[model samples]
Target: MLAQILPWYAHAAQRTAAAPAQALTAPARMGWSTHVGFGPGAEILGRDLRGKRLLELGCGPGHNAAHLAKHHQAQVTGVDLVGLQVRRARSHYGHIDGANFAVGHALHHLQATEQTFDAIYSVFGAVGLVAPELLLAAIARRLNPGGVLAFSVPHPARAGRHPSTDDHARESHVTVSDLIRLPLARWEFDAHRWGAHLSRTGLRITSTVDLRHPRLDPWPTTLLITARTR
Candidate 1:
């Protein structure tokens, strides 16, 4: 998993660094299109962010953490497995009073830290990258009881294509039917599979929202899941 994401995010760092300072300074828009356009305009995670202890997994460049700290009064810690992404986030948003960035794998951090959070979230993070059992075990330890865990994962429809021969392809887009035979590493789950996976993790699913690109239909979408620690 580390081997896969490190190079991918290294590429992301180069791409993200080239943006204008003004654009970088602006708070991050929620990366999903889902129902509405980009940004947190739809408030998919609900509206109770004030004074919460929040952690964002796979927070590339830390823009959303900075935004939450600045606007929502949340004490935010953003972690990414890749060091370059974490460094970029620190360089960009380290000055913010409530935003902190760390470079570490989420599962390892969750295991080692004494801290617990009111909520934990990932836009397109652990739910896809790590296996459910591994991720949930670590999360069960760090998330406070009844704490919210909100995350988004590529909809099962994305698994349509067969895995590409090229090692460089980050995402090989295809339909859900094609995914059954392909030997892909990323975990893309249907609602039933997701429900079963979470049940064993001591996390109870409260809702699952389907988010797709507004302009693009059926091909690529995300399942935004909100769960609570049991």
Candidate 2:
């Protein structure tokens, strides 16, 4: 399933790479939701991250990783499936003191690396794109004992779709510039279901945050979940 989506992400990388480069500075604040400053920020991870080992799954363009490394002084390693995206990340943030970017599958990278992280996070990244059970299990193996895992996904209600009762992924589309739509598969689950999955994978749920649209939308636009490895 992930293999099928690589080309789409690669195309997206190419398009984004061609655009004018933004200022090479990390964001002043970290955001978990699609909307800027809508939900909880970096405080979800902790008040301080200096000297911490961190991993970011599906770190497109490495912006968040850069923010963590530059602002919080974390040793952040970012991995993405698309090579072009990885290159773009390196080009943009490679000079940051504690930030590094690599190209590979999240599961494979997590399993292959010998090092363990203090925290592993995904911001609308691999947590939803990959199979939950497999990815969560791999994350558990890569995290140090009592480590943190935080990720965000589109709220099921945002698309007017009910959360899946089972573990299978549902078909979805990634809209680009309101013109190009790319096919993809993503898993959607309510907080209870996600808690169950995390528990089964040896992770204890810490908190869940629902970020509703600013305009009083009926449903939340993003759901952020945080867990700790047991």
Candidate 3:
């Protein structure tokens, strides 16, 4: 996994440096998938976030955190594995009063932090990169009682397009305009499996939403799950 992840981190650093600052300070809507107009948005985290403490894992560029902080009045901390991404987040969203960014591995950050949060979330982020057992346990430890955990991952059904012997993690690559291919690994699990895993971690599954393409794709493109610590 290190062999695959190291290169992707380096590529991400280069891309982060070259990427231009977003014109919008905060997103108009927060969707689970990259597909526009698919799945529920920030409403999954609850309607009112005033005075809430939240943590985002693998918070690339920190738009979600900024949105929660700016519009919802939440105290949001966004952590990314890539240093450059965290730096970019601070540069762009630092003006926001309630949002902050840091660089660290998700599991390590959760385990090391003495603070606990009222909610934790990720959008196609560390939940897919790290082993579910380890990641879920770390998250549970850092969550306050009845705290929420929400995340999105590529649907397991999508894996049928690229068959893999290993069910836990699959090697994949992202192509950017046929110029750059960023190699990465993702762990895909259906809603049933996710429910079982979350239960074992002492979290109760509250919601699961399958995000399909607007064109009516046969299989869902993304899966969003929300759970709460017991």
Candidate 4:
């Protein structure tokens, strides 16, 4: 697993190093900009996240968490399954007042935490790593009442395609145990399927956004879904 996932960490580190040094000092925002280069300015969590206790489910390299803690004033705790990623985050932002990083499975953190968060979100992170049913079960218990659970997953419509495939509507599904060749083994589902899964997990579906770039085509779009615990 380490061999398969390390490439992703390397890529994240490169992206982090390539980002402007001043971005960490940029304004705080909620939600996620899952696509590459979309910017945090396009937050999906809406405009009311400041000072809230926020949890990032799969905080890669802690850039977003650092931004929230430094710029948004959010009391942020980030958890990543990858130890290196956690190290990267702590090395960069551990000194920030309201920001911390933990290396563990998201479900473990949720299961063990006595403290409930005001908001919980993942950015192309845990939501794509774990099974949906299991992920949502923990999320429901960890989030405060009426708190937000927002996450982004790859657009299912584009998974496993050659990009030159004539079929634009083709879709695929993978079980949690499946060996997927993608950087992260993500299980993709349509909006209706996601709604059904979230409903069963005791989360009320609030909204979903299709993150399609106007200039990009023949590639999968990113899907951002926002829900709340029932």
Candidate 5:
């Protein structure tokens, strides 16, 4: 696995230097495959969020927030690290009541927020952007007592599936492929690892599902995990 991703990680470093990180990440909406990946998990998450507070950290463009608002009728707040992405989210979802967007770092803001959420959902957004411990602590701080948090992330064991069809052994060798690049990303936590972090933070893992299947992945992506705060 390491062999497969070495080139890709090398490539990602160069790309990270070239383009703004936010620009490098495409808007995750607007594709058929995306519907399958996020739609199913969102549906499950939405069910838990009915009449509840839903916080979507690292929301790319507020698409999922819109779903929670329209379908679940939950008070939703979507946050992103990049200002541009947050701007996009606000525009895309301006009309959805109980749905709002902000640009903020997840772990950082939690240290200050007096607000606690009913449920938290992150669809490949903030899960891999920081250290797992920091994120887990942040979740514990921001999530209401007994609140559940769910996320979809690249299954870490499958991290090294890089293709030779790309540049390698050079400074400019970043591959955007999820399998190779995500493992070498600035921050990445597989669902299991994140769950471990949750445990340390006083949250109990209630249930989990491997989102890796023919329907949800070119890489390993898992689904809703309902964890209760202790």
Candidate 6:
């Protein structure tokens, strides 16, 4: 979270989109400076992903897909809009046996895959700026009728701290600094909206949890959804 206060978190989105990750080499992308969360907690869920054909939407550098193939027995593929990120993921990770990463626009690209995956997942930053309806529709088409799906979405409480006004309108202040460092474009869903998409797609919610930050205390800001295709 130091990224937020330091003014980098809010600008990360801009930096990535502008430079298109062209500035960061494969090693640089996987460097010690990287701060995304894809560890033990993610591993636990991944264990359930074994033997499944898993699709990772907006998988930044394929860390989760690497974890899935190496530790969970899943055949994993990562897709992202950024060519450099996809390139870096592949170069740094190699042909991880059962894994691969590709350049993709989650909405249109996924629909063209035509193969139904056993499961689909997105980490905290997977959603990006893709329209919600487009994402769900693609998921509906790509997931086997009874396949599983899961996502880690940010909670609305994180939109910004709210201030009470006893008798007047209050302004909500959002900082570019806050938005950029956090990579928020893909982080725009809540429990209610999650339910809406799943229900329409014939997916059922099976469980939920408040994810603990890897380096800090638990953030209600991080919410996980476990669902199954119906």
> Whose TM-score is greatest here?
2
What's the lDDT for candidate 6?
A: 0.59
lDDT of 1: 0.70
Instruction: Between candidates 4 and 5, name the one with more favorable lDDT.
Output: 4
| Pairs of residues at least 3 apart in sequence or in different chains that clash in candidate 1 | 34-211, 160-174, 160-175, 161-174
CA-only RMSD, every prediction: 6.2, 1.8, 2.5, 6.2, 8.5, 7.8
Task: Give the C-alpha miss distance for residue 98 in model 2, angstroms.
Answer: 0.4
TM-score of each: 0.79, 0.93, 0.89, 0.76, 0.68, 0.69
Clashes of each: 4, 0, 0, 1, 5, 13
| Overall lDDT per candidate, in order of appearance | 0.70, 0.85, 0.82, 0.70, 0.60, 0.59
lDDT of 4 by residue, 86-202 (tens): 877777777788998998888888898898988888887787567678878888888888888888877666544332122122333322223432343456676677787788878
User: Candidate 3 regions off by >4 Å?
Assistant: 22-24, 159-167, 216-218
Local lDDT at 113 for model 6? 86
Residues 1-230, candidate 1, lDDT per residue (tens digit)?
A: 65656455645555456753332452744554344344243155558778888988888778778888877778999988888777778878888878998988888878888999988888776556776788876776788877888887767665353322332224422222323322336666666666667778888888887665656665656777778887
What is the Cα-based TM-score of model 2? 0.93
Instruction: Give per-residue CA lDDT, model 3, range 87-183, as digits (tens).
Output: 7788878889999999998998999899999999999788878888999999999999989999998777763564233547777665433477767
Candidate achieving higher lDDT, 1 or 3: 3
lDDT assessment of candidate 4: 0.70
| Regions more than 4 Å wrong, model 6 | 1-48, 159-187, 212-215
Q: Write the per-residue lDDT of candidate 6 for residues 57-116, one digit (tens) a residue.
A: 877666777777766667888887666667656765655677788876777677788778
Q: If ranked by lDDT, best first, what sequence of candidates would result? A: 2, 3, 4, 1, 5, 6
